[model samples]
Target: MLFAVEVAIALFVRDRFVRPYLGDVLAVVLVYCGLRAVLPLRVLPAAVLAFAIGALIEFGQAVNLLDLIGLRGNPVIAVVLGGSFEWLDFVAYAAGALLALAAERFIHR
Candidate 1:
């Protein structure tokens, strides 16, 4: 349902500014990590999995897999995915994953 909503919002909204807001993949990653932290899960493995998923999303975009799947290739998605070689998104993912790990520690305690 969430993925459907994201795709719908991305496709229906045609404004330039609205493009970026379609689907905040990075923020989603952060939220996913945050949830992991809140849950009783292994931090390292979960973080690694999040990082892998993020990387896959970016790489998949680079290869046009998303486009093939009917998802428009927007610059915003590219930007979020580290577009050619964006180190920032990776950093964001790492930060999110780490934050989730940290949050888990505090919450579990």
Candidate 2:
């Protein structure tokens, strides 16, 4: 569900905020959900792992990982790996991770 919303925003949302910030936030939540689905990770660990993965990818974008590996020309890979870096993305990722953590605890408790 979150992944679907993220993809929809990616494909159609051209606004400055939604596509970038909200999409980034939801992307982290989606990753957290995926982690929980496959691994028996508790909420905090999973959220931390998800946030770390997002931060690592953001760093990768900062260093131009796509161009280094020669995949920058590929559109899909570019979208998946992200084409550029934004420091604001770190905030979004953190917000997402926290949202996921709170959501899990709320649902379980």
Each prediction's total of clashing residue pairs, residues at least 3 apart in sequence or on different chains, is 1, 0
The runs of at least 3 residues in candidate 2 whose Cα sits more than 4 Å from the true structure, single-residue gaps closed, are none
Per residue, candidate 1 scores C-alpha lDDT tens digits across 2-99 of 54555565557567343343244435546465546587756677777777777676677567665566545665654445334344555665765666
Tell me the tens digit of each residue's lDDT in model 2 across 1-109: 7878987887889998998898989999999999999999988999999999999999999999999999999988887779889999999999999999899889989
* Clashing residue pairs for model 2: none
**Superposition error at 10 for model 1 (Å):** 8.3
lDDT of 2: 0.92
TM-score for each prediction?
A: 0.52, 0.96
Query: Which 10-residue window of candidate 2 scores lowest in summed lDDT?
Result: 1-10
lDDT of 1: 0.58
